[model samples]
Target: MHSLINRIMPSASGAHLFAVVALAGLFIWFGLMNLAGLTEATVERWLQPHPLAYLVTPYKTWLPYALGAIQLFAGVMIAIYAVPQRWKRVSYGLIGAISIASLSLMFTNPVWIESLGGFPAIGSGQGLIKYVAILGVALWFLGTKGANEIMLIGLILVLGWIGAMKFTGPEAEGVWPLLTGSPVFNWWLTDFGKQMASNIIGVVELITVILLTGHWWNRKAYEVGLLISAATFVVTLSFLLTFPQSWSGGFPNLSGTGHFLLKDAVLLAATFILYRD
Candidate 1:
């Protein structure tokens, strides 16, 4: 099995090394930031519009610290080439767990959906559909190489749901006009652009999810999947920066865009380590 893996696993390139190191550094930073309680200040500022702000507020207290620690651990393990070898199943299992929690939060939290709103009323339905979809996706990750597949399926579902909601829902309708009509040229339309960009990203995410999930059976495909995942992280960072309002907070506290972008940057860096030998 060791010989088979060596023959199958491609040699690590400069790009792979850079990505792995970056991932480790980011996760280490993330974990440290959480331990320092920086996440609380960040989350408190960004969640102004959330209905269950009070209910989820506890996250500010511990989640950042916890996830940051996880990031650091995952990063170190991957950087050392220990995860996909000695801890492959455990590593994937953790990914699956995180994905499930993320999906659950999406359904339960209006703020999350609101962050990605395309039109105005598209964010309706009281968050039930999102929960069901997230749960379904998370369930797909229980088997071997299931995390990638579940992610891909979730992205497809998110795209479809958002697209359909934008067309038929009221909130989405409000946001869509800014994208299509005359006001699109205005600076204020930046919010609309951000949401649209997120939707477009959803398309790419769907593709990546499918490619990564299915790549286990084909080594070449697996390599491509890693590249796609890295690219998605870059795209998300660009998208968030481009639309300041999408972040929804003041400066210094690292609310709104600051918080999210930082988190994602960290996530990207950590995940990239998985590609290295």
Candidate 2:
């Protein structure tokens, strides 16, 4: 099979160019948004349910500016081949640091879906999960061979763990709101029953994991697994459009459910790289 870069990119250097442009562009977009205060409200909402609620005011006021500056510099440093090696290292380090810090927020933030009795219901914490993939993006840009695997691991863990959770009651109920919002998925609830429908999805996800794992023996299996994984993200992202309740304060302001779906974008990117590589 032809390497995707060969078919789509002009040359081997195109791979590096792709990473630099995509990753740096994402950071640059985020930096500009944060700097413009467009994300301030969203940031404030995320902090509200945290134990450090007292820090919300101070944090919201300054975090956007600080993160914006860091992101802008990091984006520039990574994108410019002529940038000093020292600055590139600093940019990579900053990306790693911020990614780790954001991932840590999952533990500290309120994650419970109160109506479903919390624990496995996963709320605001879902928003932070993509930092894992972002960290992988950083590693890739920094020339790590394991970067692709890092992202694959992210997809596997998300599917494997959440797939397991689908067997439980709270999880089934927790996803009910999202499932009902979609005309395509709603039939599953009515026809198969809630738990059964969730179980079906869980089975598919687990099978995809199995396929990804078994790829060592059958390249075809690996290839299929990546496609399935990519499809999974595409479906979830569709929820952002199908589910009206996805938004807390309209378009740009996302609710917990919105965050959950949006994070799948990064997971989708994970599958894309795995397939490309």
Candidate 3:
């Protein structure tokens, strides 16, 4: 196991490079999804209920496209900046754009309180709030050296906590449809039954958490954890394709589940960053 970790762990510079590329990939994919009109309804749903709705209503039709373009441009810039001799001006641009975009969600998304849970309670927002980690990662790539470690710890917390929740009744029920729709996961239902299947998944997630957080103690475990985490995201992301009902009101309009699943993109990126070594 130690030898395997040594083989897989990247050089410090390589890790940073991987983190940048991972983030760029996320931005590009999300941008394309928006430009393709696939996330329009989801955007609208979040925007329409906000206090600034009227201010944004007139531009609603084109806003998503514009944002998509910006994300695409930022992604391209990040990719370009990854080159050794590249000018870092683009990194600055990305920092500004991503910071504004991510921070703006606090006001634009109405479900923040309910999803994130208020104060003492852990709510669905636990997933959404992790965007701050992405923001930190972007900043780290741009210039903040310490941000990488901070973001990694943040990822451990969020993934660990959420993974732990999978053992609880509501979360288990909530994820059932996703599990059932997934070919990779569906067989668990027949073989282990719902409760056992869910517990199995929960165990997988907790193991991932332990491995990720325990990297300092055992790099081998961390590398293995990263593999499991990546695999987990891959399975969850597959839900978007396997379940047509992910989108409602026809192709573009996302149901609650669709919105919930879409956030996996960012989490996927974080996993790469964490495992980049």
The prediction achieving the highest lDDT against the true structure is: 2
RMSD of each: 9.4, 4.7, 4.6
lDDT accuracy of residue 43 in candidate 2: 70
lDDT tens readout by residue for model 3, 139-199: 6656667766766665676667667766666666667777777787776563776667777
TM-scores of the candidates are 0.44, 0.72, 0.70
| Superposition error at 160 for model 1 (Å) | 3.2
lDDT of 3: 0.66
- Top model by TM-score, which number? 2
Candidate 3 residue 255 Cα shift, in angstroms, is: 7.1
lDDT of 1 by residue, 1-277 (tens): 4344334433546434554454445445555656667676654543444565677666656756777677567556645764555563444345445545544444344432355543333343322233332333223323334433443443334434544443333434444433343232334544546456435534555665565554457665655655666554565455444544433343333433344444444334323434443
Candidate 1 overall lDDT versus native: 0.47
Q: Please, what are the lDDT tens digits per residue for candidate 2 over residues 196-218?
A: 88888889999999888754677
lDDT of 3 at 29: 62
**Candidate 1 vs 3: which has more TM-score:** 3
